[model samples]
Target: MRFTRRKSTLWRTFESRYYVMTLLTPLGLLGLIGILVLIIIYIIRPNFQQKVVSSTYVWKLSLKYRKKRLPTSKLRDLLLIICQILVLASCAFIIAKPACIVKSTETNSETVIIIDSSASMLMSSNGKTRFERAVEAAGTKAGEVLDGGGEVTVITAGPKAEYLCEKETKENKESVLREIKGLWNDNQNDIKCTYGSDDIDGAMTLCADTVADNPKANVFIYTDATYVNGSVPEGVNVIDVKGEEESNAAIINATVTQDQNNYVFSADVIRYGTENTPLSLKASFYGVNDKSGENGKLTFELKDIPVVANETYRITFRKDVEYTDEDKLRGYKLVEESKLVLCKLVADTDVTTDEEYGVYSFEQVMFDIAESDAFDFDNHYFIYGGKKEKLKVLYVTTPIDKNGKGEENPFVPAALSIAKNYFSSRLDIEVDTVMSDKQYLLTGYNMYIFEGLKPDSMPVDGVTFLINPPKGDYKEYGFDLGLEITSKGSEGDTLSSNSSNKLLDGLKAEDITVSKATSLKNFTGSDDSPYNYESLLELNGSTVAIARNCKENQTVVMSFSTHYSNIAYGHIAVLMTNIIDYYFPATVSGTKLEVGGKIEINARGASVIARESGFTQEEFTLTEFPATLVLTRPGQYVISQTTYFGQDLTDTIYVSIPQSESALTEERYSLENPFTERDDSDYFNDLLVYLAAALVALLFVEWWLHSRESM
Candidate 1:
């Protein structure tokens, strides 16, 4: 607003810095010639002839008129000459051009404005995202610096530090504004405004380097200060732009489980901020058929849901939707043809209010009934309603026991039956006993237990348990079953067992008593061998029970025979259940992945598709067996693929906002003298147009006076 002439050696020579020197030269020359011509014309008077008058009285009147005319005409001519000279001089000066420089005593400072672009910046209040507010704050700071003739550098801190506009001058401030306002474009792939985990260290490093290069430079960071925990660079000022606290409710955890032939959906919802008002939450369930078509829908509304700040509330919904024939057909196709039964759970705010200061939030979570099993808040869960497949166990025994009775050990079958019933609530288990010499097939059995006998050859693939096997019989199955037998009535008491092993579930060393047993020495392999079995139970430093898993086939060896031991009625039942559960785990545990993280899954040359609740679906094709998927947003994602067996497989994964971003608490920081003084004289404006207007007014005044004199 304020302008003054700057004092400089170059400016002193030019006199006016706003105009071209070449144009001023010709205009000055023309003005000088016009002034000389006017002076010559005034000095050289024209010759005139005298005229006779009628009488002496006429001569007197004519003399009086001539006197009046001479004074008036002389005044007019003087005024006209002065006006012409003024016009000529003004024209020459206007052509030379003039400029007014802004006056300031402050020194110019280079400034860098860093804006936080993390996912936390997406928090909205008053219909504006935190990032939008931060950008506006940054623009204000840039304007102040630019107005003072200081250069500005705008940097955005996202997954990495990026420069939006570098070293922008006051003349190009508009360009910087455009870049900041248009940070997010139509293309989501553009990383300029993509939401990601905050990388404050990376951004701070960039600021540190900038300050190191220019020791006196000013750096201003604009953010909500939610994720900033580490040290900041020296001379950097942080401007907190966070607004008032806004209440939000998030579905932190969701799970689906089957109970009594019905699917139960449960969710853990947490409220943030200080508002203790009750929020109405609506839960909707959408069932998709085999062709990915919606068939059945169920809606549940919970009004006046009491929610305490920072507290979690549990919400449950049972299967209330009546399925039609089409829905049943879709479920049947999902189980038989490998299609997927899709279930989507959406949560939203029931009441919409126009409160300016209050925040009404909603979140939707999706689940697939066919693909999910594990209970996790960060991933979608699937509930399988179909009957579980039974585990087939092949129990092989010798024709005759040492008792000389043809009947096998009753405790063996009793223990198997007890273990089978224990898991019957969740799993189906079937045990088939056969003689070792019988022509039995091991194709469909999931497990093989050998009692005092060995198979002709080891089962190609399955879990196998060897109980009291003869040393010579195990040699053919690549097992070094070296057993050292003592007297006939020899007994070995259990010394110690691995507590971490699931197989030793309820069995204690004192509870196990083997009346007739042999010591297993070097049973698995040599001491220096790398393929040794892990000992599950030990007696006096000798292995009583050891197990090993090789190429998906788990094998267990027990030195004592169950026929002579009381382990059958004791923890043996629990041990059998543990072994069955271990080999056939309910769910395959995968790597824990977070929001905006990457994970690799087996695709098997099938098309993999992933979709979040209320978002567009993304599809990927595997060139190889496994492909990597990048999670960009937080929600329940249903990932589906087809296997070579013509079975459709789908998985549900849940991703949640990071704890650091969800907390929504502001951090305070302090600094001393973070900004430097800026010089404001560089943006001087030209005054040539004002000078030209003044010259035109003078010409009009001169013409008006001349016309009045003639009248």
Candidate 2:
């Protein structure tokens, strides 16, 4: 063997034998100091006794010694000394602590498995879904890894990539297998795959991070995905779990629109992996507000609809439509949509098509493919088109004159009339006026406006506006009004406004002048209270207009009268419009969203509850206005909440799957591994016992040679 002073060496005992020797403890080589001591001992000469009659006696003794000693005897004596030196060297080498370095093999390694859990994985073949097959494959791979004294990690690539098991060894093999099997829904049919798109990049990133410390770790991805050209990395292995080609026809999208006096239903159907297959669509509508027994829940089917593979075919269902030649070419069909029947029958009964009857129309419609395809989940879809609730406003004012003609503020009424048109497209607004002394109810209104008067208590559900509140103690509403302060001159006092406040968005504070303004004090201080206050308009550093908002209700108090302002004619309308817009915002900006789409939700009640039929249910507390909601699955979601007034408010929205996930035969994306390969796989084995054996053999040989010389 060749020994080196550095990290390792080569040890060879025979012509074909080979071993890579590594020094585990190089400090042990200090034992070689014994070689120097042995040399010093051999070099020193022993003292001899002095004699007088030596020459003749010495000559005779030397002659006798020479006659008895053969030439080979000296060679034996030299060999004995060499054997002793070799024995000493063997002890030094044993103390050096050498070992053999060998490369690691598959018996011990680290492995990571990534499973695709997207909607496309729900595709079934022979009653077994692709997700199930992927789980089985992952479990097999994990079992093999654990049996070989290796560690295994399993991660699922769903809407969000997460770990199923991390760094599991043979000791916990049973628990790891149980977790892998839990992915399949054996007992219940709850969805096993995510309805949203797969996070392939995120899964790969997690895998890369996991194997960062182990360069020789094995990574396997079990999915039906086919990578692009040269996309798969060198060390990773992707097992495609897809079987034979399967044909699928799906109703990808559906919508409902209002025509002149009827409703029109439209749907887009698409086929995958099949050419020119005859398809049919069936639709069922459930009437929610049809008081007239004329329109029951109806179902209709259109057969032999022509659709091309991978091409969207749009179908329309309407009543009393003359089919033009162009319409025939565009694939328009004449079917009695159920919503049209409900609306037409109700109109025949001579009922007004206002808020009372609008809600009684179709709430939800179920559309399905007549012939079942390989993938059943995409075969059906739902459309929710419920009517929105109207916003009701109650305005109560005191008369300045004895006549009832001055029953309400003319400026405030005019401003509300203008707001009715501005918010016409978003909400249906209704205004009711009443005298403060006359009988009026404080419940069941979205907004309460009081002028020159204060109610006993504010409504619990909706917002409230107090314009020029009369001097009184209003601790019931959590505030008190003090004596009024009039301006010294006819020019009046200039108002100071908060520019950052959204209530004063368009109104200019410098131009406004108030002849008299009341002092406001002693309101609740905590932000959680319903009377949480922020000054919007201030006169001489005292608040004249303030805005309060909390979870229970929202309020706006304007202490100054509009009649005293120099520009009250035009400015009052603008100020009133801003208050209406800020207090009563739309609940949902959009009613239709696709998977992975986000929409803003303005809570009108204590919280917002979003629920889909049998799939998803989530609740978000109404901490602030305009919270964000993300649509992770496709279904008919009903967004509802309970106001503090014990009224249940609801709105329906539709979420649909993206068009990209419909093509099961096509590969969506590819992944690449970023990890590096290990260059060195060497280990060490101790050789101290072998060196000790060699020392014993050397000592025995040295004794035999010494005995021969003595004889």
Candidate 3:
């Protein structure tokens, strides 16, 4: 079988001997002039001049003595001349670098080389990164293909796969090499491997055209990635440039949860390769808004934690002080709390382990084996989800009766308070509660909650929440309510809620009982409807609870009073929280994302400015809601924007390297051979070395012959 492998063109050409022998540097043939000089010397070589010898008898004796050996002598003389001529020719050929041209099936075959420039390629060994090695190998392969009179294409698999060069031939091999080498900066500090995880599939797709154009084209990929028990595309070759062995420690993930008076900080730490690796974990909290008499910064550490390879160890930290289960569930009640949490694996030299406020727990012991931990990018993690801004809320309820009693449902106010405490880290909530008889203005509040009362005009300035809205014609709110319907039995009617509704995210409305409800009218699902509404709660095929949104305002109407439903028992708080989340979503949807990950930006302002830790500020205009923001690098980004209501809000997003990239010894599949149908033939071998050896042997033989003749 003639497997079309990339053999050196010169070697293959000479080995196959399909074509006649040739000289690489024909100018060296000038050495052949030595043969002409030798021949000329033989012609002018002084013919035996007839001279009167002093002794004819001696000459005659010598002639007779030589006659016996004349035949041998003549043969020797002829042999010597032939050897001299051959030696001169050998010298010429050696200088010319003689090579045989043998036909090889791969001569005209194209080669496509893909270089993986992912973040994991930044692994360094012997001062050279994997990307550097891959680039070098790619260049060498390209040169070989070009020298064989075949075209070469170079592609890079980074965040996106793209071609570095296409159809490069020997004529422009140098330029192609230059382009590949340009992936690294002069200092080698900045490389094209800034992107996480390679897009190998994309890169291979780029080779499709070349393969189509040349059916015999060979595709090769140089990367540090490995696939475990996985096979790559058929007919492609994968060259793994991984180091001998590598060990890495990564803080793969981190998050904070409110635990009563203290916060619980947890992180996933992993050691890629190395058994019983001893490492320290450090947790630092900045801008922590807590109820603890103290504030500012809090740090905790776990020292000499032996982490096993390939295992994820979850470490959790909380207040050193003790608390109850209730406190644990509620999280420490804090006057103020902002947790800009940072978790990192301490390097070998940093030995400080602080267990002051909280101790840490290592949940698992994972083990795998690798040699070096040179890639340090994934060691640190940041959690900035705890920081929040201010949100103003206004609550209006019915006035007091003659007995100094109010007709208000206390459940609404209670749910609001619960939501305020639950989202304390993300929002500083200020609530103003007033009786319906008092003068209440809704223009300044971020949210307005009204219960058991109807205003002359609907509030259009903020998110409107009408609890047990009374029957009325509310043209300003775009929808009106029908007469209140009373249930016939005390058991009340079980309502079914739209589980898909964002406002009912965690509530089970089917279990709730409502004895009375008002039906909503004119909420048809139509483009021409005055309000863009979504039914949240339904009873007997009628929408009892509704949510609507527009550019000018947002409204949520619950037709049933809290007193008439089982919702006040416990579901009210959860429903309120979901409502707040849906309307006032965070500026950035997620707290953490992988490098090259895209995040949704739902800015309340006209524009948003994102500033990453080590990058320039990026500004995006909010032409619409939920804009896409692509994070290309690993860092903490602060997104800031001012809402239309003049409320300045800021959020933090952490971009990290893909966890897969830290697995230094991940199993990878090799590229399959796409040229199965191609002729498999041995390439021509180079004849330069053999010719030099022959030349040396000829020289030695000529010297021996000359020495014998002299004797």
Candidate 4:
């Protein structure tokens, strides 16, 4: 039941609050207080009005009127109270500004920094390597999160996927920024993620898998426009950075090749864009002649390339061509490998009858083998840097006619036919056909095929066949098949009649199994010393199948030709394949490329040891070596090093370089995620808005408090 009344005063009616900065701008508080005092006395005073009231009974009503009109603190104490509220509000607002600068608790935070280290990142995009600028920009934003006490994980997006910083330990601004400064677009720098081939598809999956384990975590991906072709992970924030220039075209194709002559080389060229893209092509062929001058320069005829696109050309060389090709397209031949090349061919004519019915087929066989290779030199005459795909055959025939007449021409006709048959078949072996005639001597072949030709003149160069030569010369020309020498040689190495060659006096039951040699009837006791092979079809007096020896090379001698028996043809072909596979060997030059290559290759139990520019030499040792070896360049390779028993052998890898500019456009963009937003994006803007609102509200409160204090 309190009653009160008052006459309105200018200072009492208007309240002017004062602003005081406690620690900062303390002088500002004094100026604000002075203005408040002035406003209350001068500006507010002239407008002051008075209301009069009287008697005690009226005062009671006046008290209710006062409470209704005022509804505030004691008017007598209003000046002090207003001064206190104004000073406090100023301090409170300044402190509250920090809250506006920060964000709400996002709970667990996943900050992924996807740095672009692709080839395009090397270009100056926005004044720096797109990579360099990206790292700087990412660092600034990472600070905001770390400043807010959140954790961060830094990732790298390049040809190799990696993590520069793990999402471990409490995030520190200094440490994060420090890591950013040391960050490099190289492997030795980012060792956490082992480098693999460029496969962004897998990398995208990895990015998602990394954070998917922790649900409700926010993801921030920062990168350049290299990842245009790649997909962004789910629930990820993408902060994309784009460079100012995307117009540079670089040479992406550099490849190596192997030719028919076993020569190796590499070629690369640049393409130009017709736009204001003033470009240069500088090719330094390493591991070869260092002609740094324009002497090695090669220019192209194409011109006016489209913007961001280029017209490309090539530079090529080989080992056999002359060093001077200034006028030719294929220039500068490397040194040639000596060509003491050995060649051979097999005749289709089979001869494995107990008797000698020799018809010569050497001429026809030689002619066909040469003609078959005419289509492409690589198919037919690839030299012996290694071996080619063809069996090595040993054709042994006598120059005597079926009737034993010494007609050289007649015997040769049938001999040549035999050669054709054997050559076309699996005996598709390379052979040196020895002739008794002075006109045609054995040359250029690895194994010898004697067709009734005198074994006397045949050198020990290859396998020799003595057609039932009176076991005399056998001591020097053959292996000892019997327990002892049947006859002795005049000289230790002479293939004369006295050569040690013998047959067992008596045949044992197992000498030739009846089942294994059904054809051997009356020929059983005949001296089988001339032939020493696992018999395929043996007849009584002689064998249609046998094995022979000349030095380390094992030769099989059959007693009949296809002219003698059709049955021998089957065994002949089988033995031919086996023998050829044994002798005609193949050598491999492993995969070779410029250091950083596209397609990596490997062969069975082998490694590329030496590489001079483009030539990768892959070596393999002989284990039941085959007589032929073949290879193709720029291919998906499957190399094998298996023993004759198919046991495991050594294995090595080779890789081919990508060609220049063919698909320089094929390798698409890098890992730039435009859809992935930065964790502190428009959020920073939101903070700014809060700071602005807080500052404005602060001004009004202080002004009102000062006006009251002045009264």
The positional error of residue 257 in candidate 4, measured at the CA in angstroms, is 10
Identify the runs in model 1 with alpha carbons over 4 angstroms from their true place: 1-112, 123-129, 132-183, 192-219, 225-249, 255-265, 269-313, 318-441, 470-472, 480-484, 487-515, 518-546, 565-633, 636-651, 659-711
Please provide, for model 3 over 223-260, each residue's C-alpha lDDT reduced to its tens digit, 9 standing for 90 to 100: 88775455775667789898776667777777667655
The 10-residue segment with the lowest total lDDT in model 2: 338-347
Q: What does candidate 1's lDDT look like per residue over 382-449, in tens digits?
A: 23222344577899887665654587767777778988777764456888898776778866677898
Candidate 4 lDDT, 494-547, residue by residue in tens:
111111221111222122222111121121223654333344333443343445
* Weakest lDDT window of 10 consecutive positions for candidate 4: 362-371
Task: Give me candidate 3's TM-score against the actual structure.
Answer: 0.61
Backbone atom clashes (below 3 Å) for every candidate: 8, 1, 38, 102
Candidate that would win on TM-score: 2
Give the CA lDDT, 0 to 100, for residue 339 in model 4.
11
Shift of residue 635 alpha carbon in model 3, Å: 1.1
Q: lDDT of each structure? A: 0.61, 0.74, 0.72, 0.38
Please state the error at residue 303 of candidate 1 in Å.
Answer: 6.5
Leading candidate by lDDT = 2
Which order, best to worst by lDDT?
2, 3, 1, 4
